[model samples]
Target: MDFRAINTIVFAFLITMCSFGQINCNCSIGSYLEKIELLNTRDSLEVFELSAELKKTKLEVCKFKALEIEFNYFITQLNEEKAFAVLNELEDYLGRINCESDLKFNIYINKAKYFKLHNNYEKLSEFAFKALKEAEYLKDSNKEIEAIKQIVYLFTRMDEDDKNWQYIKRAEKLIFKQSNPIRSVKNFRWLAFEYETKYTRTKRKPLLDSLFIFANHSKKGAKKYNIFDELALSYRALEAYSYHKGNAKNALKYIDSAIFYAKKIKGKKNLSGLYISKAWDHLDWGEKELAVKWMDTSFAYDTKDDIAGFMMHHLDATDLYEQAGRLDKALSSYQIHSRIKDSIFNTERTQVINELETKYKTELKDAKIKRLNVLLVITLLIIVSILLAGSVIQLKRTRKKNKILKRAIEEQERLEKELSDVRGEIAQDFHDDLGNKLARISLLSSLISGEVSIKSPNIKSKIKQINEDANGLYKGTRDFIFSLKSNSDYLEEVVTYLSDFGGDIFNKTEIKFTVEKHISTNVKLPYYWSKQIVFIFKEALTNAMKHSNCHTVKLSFGYQGYQLSIRCEDDGIGILESDLQSLNGLSHMKTRGIKIGCELLINSNIGEGTAVILKGNLKEDII
Candidate 1:
């Protein structure tokens, strides 16, 4: 109702809303703490499950940042006694993770602490030096200082007293003049540790006094919960120093203190190495049975495949068994050692030989195939050489025969030319002189027959017979001249003429004749040889048309290289083998083929038609 009352109510509502916001903030904080506890307890799977839930609840950034913080908290919980085991797990975890810069720095520092706690001086120096490099990259002055301190401590543990002092002196030079008292104090503390634990080993009282003074100054800044592991390591260093100084009682006393803090923050994996160290200490005290018992416990906890650790345990077991006169047990342990040594050597030898054996076998097979291929090539070359030699011998004989045949052909050509000239002269004389006289006689006989009438019919018949005989003699002279002219043309012309003549004969016999073009004008043969080949083809076609009673006849002629071939095939009642051997036509064909240096092949059977193939080389005289 009132304006003042409304304003007061608004103010109260604002305060109440602010209060609820604070409560929600506190609840979120509480949940983050619980997740940190889970990580510290090595419950990574549970933390991962919670992270998934957080992502679904719109807290992805919060959950992811929490994971980073939890990783640091887990590192803090890992005690100095279990430092090596924790470092191993941390290394494994780092290998599995893709961590950011801040988280990575924290992991590195924890790793340095673990190596330091185990008194692994070399590894401690290495990791601490690496951590310094990472810190330089990060440009974090605080991490750099921490890394330098760890490195100095590692060198001290390694008995590199001068190097340790050098690093601490450098830190002192850098930080002693700074305005930041806390940083100055921390530097002073490391310098004191370097001089007291490292340099004081040689009984240098002046350096010890300097160490005591600086350590007193460092007390304020050194009060931090995370430094507990470092403190325990410092005590172990003191114990080692006492042991080296020949004060066993004092060394044991410091070792107890070292163990106290080491147990307080022990890690899961590092307990085995710490126990082994403790076993060694007991052995030094002549507590053999207790040392053995601690060693067995250490062995049980050793989950890593650390060769040095296994060897140490093996040697200890062997000594104990041998001293107890258990020869069989000692022998068994020795056999194991021998077996491991042999297996390593054999593995290396096997690896070296494996590649060689593979190459050897491959090359061996290739060589065998190459040998076989060479043998096959030699055999083929021998066969080819024999064939070439036989061909060469036959060709030489053929050349000799061809020379003789060429001489004969030249002589025959001359004789034939002379005979052709004489025949032409004889045909002209018969046509102009004898032919006109016969024609006059025939005209006179006709006139005489007409005048004689019925009284002399016998004389008239005799005169008419004389006129018919004179006409027959003139036709024979004309045919002889044409035959002589036909012999002068090339073989191709002769083939054409014979094919045309054969077609005419087939037409008369009512048999189909198919002529295929065979010889070309380029083919040359002697006049006599050409005449003989044409006559042979003509004769074969005549026999097929007249005697074979063939319905279809195929005539083919072709020239291959120097050889001219003619083939005649007819569908007819074929000749038997007996008849082929005795047939005069076949004998005449063979004789004609021999005279022309041609090969005549006759293929005939009882049902299949006869095929005559004539093949011959063109005479060189014609070309």
Candidate 2:
């Protein structure tokens, strides 16, 4: 075997040993923190395994810490949905514990980081400002500076140069006021990086100058404290400043110096990140060969056992190698990267599904929901595969490309919410627009009946019919709107509405209208069922008033076993049995009844009365 293969096996074995050591760690908050910290040390994919163990822990505090670590993991991985999940749990746990201000401050900071990652500036601002206040209350300069840095980071990401510089300068002044300024070494380097980022964005000369000052200040702190990481990062900033200033020789000098310090610590692990970043910069600069060299160097240092770090560098290195026309190496790197990517994607998918299933099962107790969870997982998998696509062949992580696999689920939720809102809006608009016009038509007919005098008797009779027709339409529209808005599941509500309509149609006439309910239990009716049932009964009542010549009409609601029954009966000079089916109103009621899975029956005699009864299986409709 080649040396690299031997090295890989050794690294894997050592990590397995460390992980096994950590796995049986005593159940405590400290153990949870240490295990989660392995995310930084061992591998990013270790987060999934460690989080699984943390979930099974009985300690809420450990769970809270695990979620915090997972939040950072997801944020770095650009998995916004999982990040959102961790943030939600962490927030919930925070409230349950009623943690002190220091802990609350950290949680707020975590929240701010999450919103920043998701590009939710509105929420980022809220939490970032909250952290600032907490820092002030705690009177911790480091915390205060950290909060300010976060706010500055937000504005920087948003490309708000004015706001970014304002916060950066404010943090700068505060850090300088401190006695040692050594505690703020990393803070200075962060400010330097921000300046470097701003300079890149705007290409402003002043930003370039400010970055040099901060880099120098960071270097001073690093030299004073012998903080090798900060020392190397300071030189990296200086290198960037020099390179941007068109001093390539000086830039190379600073980079070599940075590497010198970088190699002095951490087995060049940090150097791998620096190399990959610069490799990307060089690749963007069109120096493909140099980019390839640096990418390979970074990959060499990246631990093969650190699955996420390996995949990250390999993915980027694939792009670099591809651009350099090293097709064989690119293909090899891409294969490994794709395999790891697919593994992580599948793991995250199962985790999200499990979380959703647990949440839904807790909130909704139904076998149907369990069935729906299966569909959810299948749908999620399909969407992730579709969106992911052959871009895995390229394997570069762009912001647009890194929108997170759970985007499909979030987008589905958003669309569902939008659809419900539109339904409500359309229903309201339908009611308002048609209801007003119908009411106007009825008012006009009433005015024409009382105020206008028609000389011909036939014309006057026609006018009375028009007025009654207009009133019937106006009342029908009102009932339809009521049914549309009602959320009641019981059939009794619809029966009451029909009875009220019967009273309205028979008003001022010599007809008595009675409504009776013999329901032993609530028979559930769907939303569409309510509108259909009401309209069917309305047609029966209108027919009884206009044609049945009924002196008394009764509407009854009843339920038996699993069946629903409704009757509209009238005592009038009834129709012939042959004419019962031939009645004009009977057809419309039957059509509406068919929609609700009901059979409409018409019973009439020449001298007795007519009864329109409806029967249907309530169980089927409910299902």
Candidate 3:
């Protein structure tokens, strides 16, 4: 075949395939829609059959867009009275896929209505709140209104009048802005119910007035099918208010109006409530037989499963039978009353127990979590304590080692100082007494050798040489002893020694020296301590002379009150920054100053001259 003919055939084949696929897709979607329609119409058996078929078809299609359309249809089906079918479908759909916001909201609304019909008030209230939140997110006003109405109804049934009033007000505000007569009338009716119920519970007159106003508003231009029950309830509330106010005639008149409106409604079940109201009025007026007759008629008319009204009727019958002295009838009625009362009490107790169980489980869970946290903290503390104890033991061992090393160093320093002092004393003894005696002996030997020189001229020359060498040795020893004994003095003597020493040093450097003495004989040891401090000053000045390349130095000593101060200054190149960390010369000087109970301050900078200050508090012995 040619290329053009082949292309034409391929195009036609593709179109046919596309058409077949569209037909199959539409058929699958149609099947899902038909199943939802049956469910919405309350055909539960057919819904179950169709739902199974749809599930198979969905697997065959396996498309998300098709699934979404199916979900939307399921949401529509959920709005109907056959809610079990819808809930089953919803559980499947929610399990399979996520629904759109509008679809989810519709599902919640349907679930809330279904729960209300089942008399599951707690679930009804919970779903109503859920629907309200979804409706708010979708911004759907009708859904919002419906959800609010359901919430108000649930709250009223549960006897939560405060919450009932709050939702009722919200629904009323929404209804006021809508032009729909049916919705507006419904809102007004609910508002009237809220006010009447509040009045019944609180016996407040203002609530009765509010109920009448809303009832009248609801009946305005409304069809007969609407507003009848609300109008009757409003009249009954007014009658109750009148009864409370002691206006018996007005109360009877309003009760008659209540019966009239209630009878106008087509249903006998609806009319039973009016009969009960009339029986209450008769019983209040002390007509016991008439009240019993009305109550029996009311019971005959009550066809629906109104448990509260049924219980109340039996209770009233028992009361009336007792008052009439019919003991047998009274016993039978009382038995029925007791049965219903027990049922209600048991139901309330079950609800309370369920709530308490839930609370207990929650508390148990919180207690477990708290216990775990406490255990974790305690474990951490124990671990930390062990680690801290090890660290403390190690630190103590390190401190003990450091103390032993420090004591050894101090003992070595003490031994070295003692050895230095002993060597100085031995050198002084050789110089002072032994050297002088050796010098005298050498002179006497020289004289004896001279007298015998005529006999031995050679011996005379040798003797003269020996005498000169002995004299030189004697002079060296005398200078050594004099240096050792130079600083040994009492207070007054030490002060005199420092003045002479400082004057001699200043003369050598051509610097000035000034001494101010406060030497009391009582200050002997203090003055002796200052003499050692003078050695520190001498070392600092000698350092300045060697390194400072300047000519002038000044030394000053003074005492004021209890303090003695010595200052030595030099106008020379000061200490270098690099030499400040050295521990040899300046450190020794500072140690000497500290030994004498002095605080030594060295003020020096590069090229700024040096000043050494020694200050100490004089002892009381000196004072």
Best by lDDT: 2
lDDT of 2: 0.72
**What lDDT does the true structure give each of the candidates?**
0.62, 0.72, 0.63
lDDT of 2 at 16: 62
- Evaluate residue 573 in candidate 2 and report its C-alpha lDDT on the 0 to 100 scale: 89
In model 2, the clashing pairs are none
Query: What root-mean-square deviation over C-alphas does model 3 reach?
Result: 30.0
- The sequence of per-residue lDDT tens digits that candidate 1 reaches over residues 323-418 is 545567557766765554453334454444334334534655676688678657555555655587889998999999999999999999999789
Query: Candidate 3: misplaced stretches above 4 Å?
Result: 1-100, 103-106, 139-145, 152-178, 223-269, 308-623
Error in Å for residue 548 of model 3: 99
lDDT of 3 by residue, 27-146 (tens): 335545433422322233443455456556644332433333344344333333434664655656554543333267666776776665555555665677778766765666767888
Could you report the Cα RMSD, in angstroms, for every candidate shown? 39.1, 28.5, 30.0
Q: Which is better, 1 or 3, measured by lDDT? A: 3
Candidates ranked by TM-score: 3, 2, 1
Deviating ranges (above 4 Å) for candidate 2: 1-102, 117-122, 136-141, 180-182, 201-209, 223-226, 260-273, 276-288, 291-623
lDDT of 2 by residue, 523-579 (tens): 668658888888788888888888878789998888888878889899898888787
Point out where model 1 deviates above 4 Å: 1-65, 69-139, 146-235, 264-269, 276-623
Q: Please rank every candidate by lDDT, starting with the best.
A: 2, 3, 1
Residue 165 C-alpha lDDT in model 3: 74
